[model samples]
Target: MQIYKVGGCVRDRLLGRPVKDKDWVVVGSTADEMLAQGFRPVGKDFPVFLHPKTHEEYALARTERKTAPGYHGFEIHASPEVTLEEDLARRDLTINAMAEDDDGNVIDPFDGQTDLHNKTLRHVSNAFVEDPVRVLRMARFAARFGFQVADETKLLIHQMIANGELEHLVAERVWQELEKALLSNQPSLFFICLREVGALKTLFPEIDRLFGVPQHSQWHPEVDAGVHVMLVLDQAARLTDDLAVRFAVVCHDLGKGTTPADILPGHKGHEQRSIALTHALCERLRVPREISSLALKVAEFHTHCHLLFELSSCEVLNVIEGLDAFRKPQRLSQYLLACEADFRGRPGYENADMPEKAAFQACFDAASKVSAAAFVNEGLKGPAIASAMADQRCRIIEQMLKPFRKNTGGTAS
Candidate 1:
């Protein structure tokens, strides 16, 4: 039986990145043969196993058929006769189609190594049209690998979208891929590409409306909602690595277009209104509730950072306290990073540089070591704690002393 290292592990090794996992493609080996070699069978519809010794995945050579629409319609056939070439041919992208022998001889029948070297993402075969999920995967990979899709591949994707092939994808899968894409270093590229190919409108009609929507030119010289979103996404990548925070970056300020005026003139509670809109958007995208909740909280309160310059130490702690009452105080750092990124995305709000960012981080560091006794010892407890904790005195005090609840009350003014 010939066993070869395949897909991402090998690709990452070639790219000098840490290989997260090892996967194998086995040719000339049956499922029974794999089990005989002490591998645990795992694949339900195909022949895939986990090696008993190394606990690495070993998938037997298999072919697939599209019995219906969407990604789940695949019918697979596993056999000992399937060749490495045949298996690689069915792959989505050239960069992911490479394989290597036991001695490390690269098997690249599709010139995937060249594409990898050139940083180009291209489909391996015309069979790419068989699955609608490939478009989303392309967008995500473009963001992940920081590479552009090949022209021919882009053409195929456009054709698929035109034919409504993407409608076959379920909401969960769409959100899953969208989540990864948004978490990438340049999530805007994916959204921009999706818009260009018309998939953005088809999949997310609400966001599709965001493209041509106008913002106040004085504050948002970026002009259009889409560009503003892209700018925020770029800054979001620089802000934090937290997925929920990044989700806020992608979704915050989404309500701007819904206003009657060209500029959201005389708008009140825009932040709170946007939070509600973000929740609906996240739900429509099928994002998990916990993540959606974080996004909404961050979006709702992001504007409060404007008061950070005017805040007292106790006031700062109070703001922190109020935030902590809703979620983990540790997440405040993430929220702050999201705010910093959002501010940077705007025309004149790029003032928070490394020093400013570090100052905010220092507050988080200090909060982490702070305890209830520290508050009392500092004579900062009870009525001395500031009037913002009027109704939440005990709750706020408990949270202040509690290491995990640093942001529970005291900063409304």
Candidate 2:
């Protein structure tokens, strides 16, 4: 059996980037031959195994044919006759279709090297549109490498989306690609690519509808709600590698997309609308609880976070309690980061000063000292104890954050 290092490892190595994981393609081998070599059979639908010692995935070279609709419609044919080139041809992009021999020789059967040098994500063949999931994968690759999508590939993805391919994609697979892209260096590109081909409208209409929508010019200088969201998503990517925070930023302004036409740029009480849309999006995507929880909270109160300096101490305490910061301090940390992204995600606002995060954190720190345990010790119970604690926290926040009180209304500093 001949084995070759294939796919992302090859692409990343050629691009002078760090390779995270290695996938091998074994040509001229069968499932029995692999087992004879003590490779553990793990693939349910195809001939794939794990190396006994290295435990790296080694999939036998195979070809796939569409048997039905959706991503699961593929029928795999793995055999000794399946050549390496045929296997590479089935990959989503030219950059990911390249491979390397054991002697460190790259095998570029489809001019992947040229495309890589040009930083272009082109498909290897017309078969690129066979699977609906490629629509999301292409966008994900764009986000990961910041590479330009080839014109033909864009057309092919559009063809796929236009023919209801996106409608057939599994929600889990869509979220998988989205989750990975959100953690990428240029995550906004993922959604941008999707929107370019109209797949965004089909798959995530909540997000896609944001593109042409107007925003309050005074607050969002970019004036387009969708552009604002992309900026926020990219800002979240820059601030940290936290997926929840980035995902929250993505959903924070979804309500703006559904604003009344007459309202134009002014979206009053958009947060409440945003919360409902965010909940629907989370439910549709089957988003993980940890991620969706934060998304919902950010949707509900991100503006509140922005207006922290102008808010009364009681309001500040409400934000802290709403986030349950005392119990899950980590939530507050992530919440603050997402709010900062929103605050700075506007044009000419990326470097603006945001004092709301720090002041609110200070408020939380001082108010956290007003413990329920102390209230309980005073024979307070249930709602009475909660009210007393809320009052004390409000007082502490008022005293602690008084100096930052201003009419900034969380706008760009």
Candidate 3:
């Protein structure tokens, strides 16, 4: 059997990116032969093995035929007779179809290297429309690499959407691709790419509807809610690599999309509306509770976070307690990051300093230090102890904001 490094490893290497994982394609290797050689079988639908020593994945060179709709309705064939060329032809993008041999020889059967040089994402074959997941994957790659989708590939993606292939995509697979996109350096490109191909409407209608929605130009110079969210996502990526934070930023403005048209730019009470939409979107996608919880909290409290300076110490503490900041300080920090992203996402404000973030963080730190143990020490029980804790935390917050209130000539509410 001849083994060659294939897929993303080769693609990233050619692009001068750090190779994160190595996948091998074994030509002229049977599943029984691989098992005999101590390669552990891991693939359920195809012949994929793990190296005896390195434990790296080794998938047999195989070809696939489209049998039905979606990504799962494919007939996979792996045998000693399957050629590596045939296997590579089944790949989604040209850049990902290239492979490399042990002797350091680059295999370019589909001109993937040329497309890589051109900074283009091109399809390998007409069979690209067979799997809907490929559309998401390609969009994610565009976000990661900042590459332009070739005209032909764009047409194929449009055709796939027209054929209703995207409707067959399952929620888990959609979220899997979305999570990857959210973690990319330019996550907004992921949504832009999907919008270009009309897949966003099918997969994320809530987000898609935001494109043409108007926003107050005074606050959001970008003027479109969709563009504003994309800017927020990019800013969020700049602040943290946490997927939960990124996801929260993405869903924070969903309520704005549902604003009454007569209201035009004003989004009064949108925070509550956003909470409901966030829940629906999360439930539909089967998002994890941790992420959904954080997103919901951000959706409901982001406005409160922005209005921290105007709120009373008690109100600020209430927002902090609503976020469970005392128990999970990291969530509070993440919420601040998402809010900062939103605040700076507008045009001519990208570099604006956020004094509110620091002020809120300081307030949270002071309040978090007020221990409930002291109330318990005074023989306070249950609701009494909880009441005492709230009073003490609010007092601490009040003291913490005293200096800032002087500078602004504002009194506590």
Candidate 4:
């Protein structure tokens, strides 16, 4: 049996990226023969083994046929006769279909190397349409590598959408791909690619509806709620690598889609609507509580966070307490980051500073320092202690923000 290094490792290496994992394809090998060696069986549906030493995956060279629908509807055929080329042909993208031998010889049967050189993402074969997940995967790859999808590949994706292939994709699989795309270097491309292939409306209708929605030109020169969201997502990526923050930013403006047309570009009371929409979307996707919780908080209070400098000390303290900033300071910081991204996402505001963030953080720092033990030591009990804590926290915020309020000539409103 001849073993060859294949898939992402080879692709990454060719692109001068640090290889994180390695997968091997064993050509001319049977399951019995693999077991006779030291490889441990691990694959549930097909022939995959674990190397006894390195513990890396070693899947047998195999070919598959589409049977029913979705990604799971595949019939696998693996035997000693299966060629490495045949196995490569079943891959999604041409750039990922290339393999490498032990002697450092590169195999490019589908012109993966040529496509790589051209910075293009092309499909491997006509079989690419068989799996609906490939549409998401290719979009994710576009986000990760910043590569343009070939015309033919785009055509195939459109065809897949027309044939109702995307409808078969499971929610978990969709979330999995979406989470990965959000963490990519260019997360906006993921949504852009999905929109191009008409899958965004199917999978993320809430986000899709934002495309034509208008926003106040004074606050959002970009105007379109969808464009604003994409910009916010990109800015969130720039600020932090936290997936929770990025996801919150992505859903922060969902309420804008539901704005009343008679109100034109104004989006009054969108915050509560955004909170409801975020909850519904999170529930549908089975998103983790930590992510959904942060998202909900940001959706509800992002406007509060933005207007912190203009609000009263009591208002600032109320916002901070509502976010549970004292107990979970990290969540507050994440919320601020998302808010900052939103502030700077609009046209001509990309490089603008967020003084409100720093001011709010300072207020939080001062209030968080208020000793609960001090209040309890004053013979205060239960409800009395809670009132004393709120009073002290508000006083602390007032003291810290006094100078800024005076400078702006603004009263506690």
Candidate 5:
């Protein structure tokens, strides 16, 4: 059997990027032949094996046919007769269809190298629309490499959306792609790509609806709610690599999209609306419990964090308790970051100083210092102990934030 390196490892190498994993396409091979050669059987739907020593995946050259719908609607055929070019043609993108021989010879029958040189993301063949997941993969690749999708490919994506291909995507697959895109340096492009192709409305309508919505100009120089949110998502990526924090930033403002049109730019009481929408989106996407919970809290209390200086100590304590910060201090830190992203996301406000971030951090730090052990040792029991601890925590936080609260008056928004 002859094997050639293929897919991401080849594309990344050509772009001078550090290759993380290697995938090989083996031609003139059968499943039995791979097993006899000490490779471990791993692929469920196709003939894929693991190298005996390196344990890297080596999939036999196979071509797939669409059987029904969704990503799993595929009929795989792997045989000795399956040519490397045919296998490559079945890939999602032109840049990912190239292969490399062991002797360092590059194969480019699909002109993938040319697309790479042009910084373009083009489909390998018309068969690209067979799998709905390619739409997300294309957007994710754009986020990763900052490559523009070819006009023809973009048209194909629009067709996929029109023909209901995107509606078949499972929640798990959508989350997987979204999580990867969020990790990229410019993840905003991923959402923008989906929006441009109308796939956002099909897969993530809550986010898609945010595009034409307006926000208060005084607070958001970027008046479009969707634009403001994309800026926040990118800013969160810049500030921290924490997926929870970044995801929180992505969902923190969903309520603004659903605001009453009569309210126009003023999104009064949008926080509660955002909280409900965040829960629905998380539930629909089957997001992990930790991630969903953090996102929910950020959506609910982000306003509290942004308005920390204006809140009384009791209100600040309420915010802390609402976020469950005393139990998971990480939530407090993460919530602060999400709120900071919102403040910095507006146009001309990218580097503006947000005192509320520092003030909120200080409050949580003070609350952390107050111990339940102190109240328990004082003979308080059950709910009494909790009440005493809350009181002490509030006093500590209040003492720390006296100067800011004094300067900024009024109740929490």
Candidate 6:
């Protein structure tokens, strides 16, 4: 029997990052044998045990079955005779396929170390198509490691996409990996990779519609909504890696595809439509209500409120006063960041070196000074009698005041 370190924990260690979790693969081991040794058996579909002392994960060297499709379809085979090489072969990417023996001798059958040195992501075997999740995983790794997928690996992914292998991935798994990719350091590459593989169409078909859609030639010299979105994503990667902020980048212009252009001319309420679309998309992905709701508000109001930043303080205050429904100070900060990214992505010489950074800094300072609770407690009673607020009157008022009441003694917009 051989116990060895495998996957990201090992990969990250080689890269000199703090190893968050360490997983061990026990070759030539069975569940019963592990249990006999007093390890706690845990994995439902596969043989996994918790080390009695360290309590770290110890998964048995097992083969898998393609019961259906996607990540969850795999049926595991845990046998005492399973080889470490066999387990590594089933992995999606070479970087993750590397393992380390007890004495720290690295195993590199697929030349994972060489690829790591080259900063390239390549599949371990052609069995890459066996699991549709590999495509998303590959994109995520690209974002995480700043590695370009090798030509052969990219070809395999494209082949899988053309063959409809990626269609087997469920929405939940797609969102999970997509979210990870979005929150990574190079999220734009992930979407670019998806676009290359033709899997973006299979995953978020809505995004596919943005491809050829035209934009205002004068304002958007970039020419199309897809290009604009890609630029915004690139802008996001250059900025923070916050999930909420990145979600805003991915979703801010979703309504553009549906806005009636010619008749309305520039299409009023595109921001509102964007929010509605964001909510529906978040719902489909089954994201948390708190995060999704906040993201929706940011998308819905970003374009509208951003224009107001150039207005007088009176106008800005009026807008902020109307924003009583928004309680989170970070909400506006996130919106400003999204707007700055969007604005910078917008094509125009005048748009460059705009006051957005100063605007965001001002808003952040204001939020630090004023708490949401103070705003709510400023002699405002429960629920506005207005029809628009009837649904959210109580909750909205409560959130508005939360920042106001805190002992920190501050007001924030």
- Candidate 2 Cα deviation (angstroms), residue 277: 0.8
TM-score of each: 0.80, 0.95, 0.95, 0.95, 0.95, 0.79
User: Which lDDT values do the candidates have, in the order given?
Assistant: 0.73, 0.86, 0.89, 0.89, 0.88, 0.72
Model 4 residue runs over 4 Å out of place are: 261-268
Q: Backbone clashes per model, in order?
A: 9, 1, 0, 0, 0, 18
- Which regions of candidate 2 deviate over 4 angstroms? 261-268, 376-379, 406-413
Encode model 4's per-residue lDDT on 299-323: one tens digit a residue. 8888877667578899888778778
In the order shown, the candidates' Cα RMSDs to the true structure are 6.3, 2.5, 1.9, 1.8, 1.9, 7.3
Query: Candidate 2 lDDT, tens digit per residue, 1-413?
Result: 89999999999898898999999999998999889989999959878899999999999999999888889899999999999999999888888898999899999999999998898889988888888888788889889888888888888887887777778988899899999999899899999988877788888999998988877756785558899999989988889999999999999988888867555322445877888999999999999999999999998888877777667788777777789889999999999999999888988889887888888888888888777898889999999998998888887887776566634433222
TM-score of 3: 0.95
For model 1, where is the 10-residue window of minimal lDDT?
A: 404-413
Better of 1 and 2 by lDDT: 2
- lDDT of model 5 at residue 305? 70
Q: Where does model 1 exceed 4 Å of error?
A: 263-266, 269-273, 307-327, 347-388, 391-413
Candidate 6 residue-wise lDDT, 1-413, digit = tens: 88999999889988887899999999887778898999998857778899999999999998887787667877888898889999998898888998998788999788888888999888888889888888888888877887888889878878888878877777788778988888777687787777776777877766766777787655565658877887887676676666777787788788777776652212447766777778888877887666676577667556544454333334344444443434555666666677677777765632475454455445434433443454365555445323223323333433443443343343333
Name model 3 segments beyond 4 Å from true: 261-268, 376-379, 409-413
Prediction 2 TM-score vs. true: 0.95
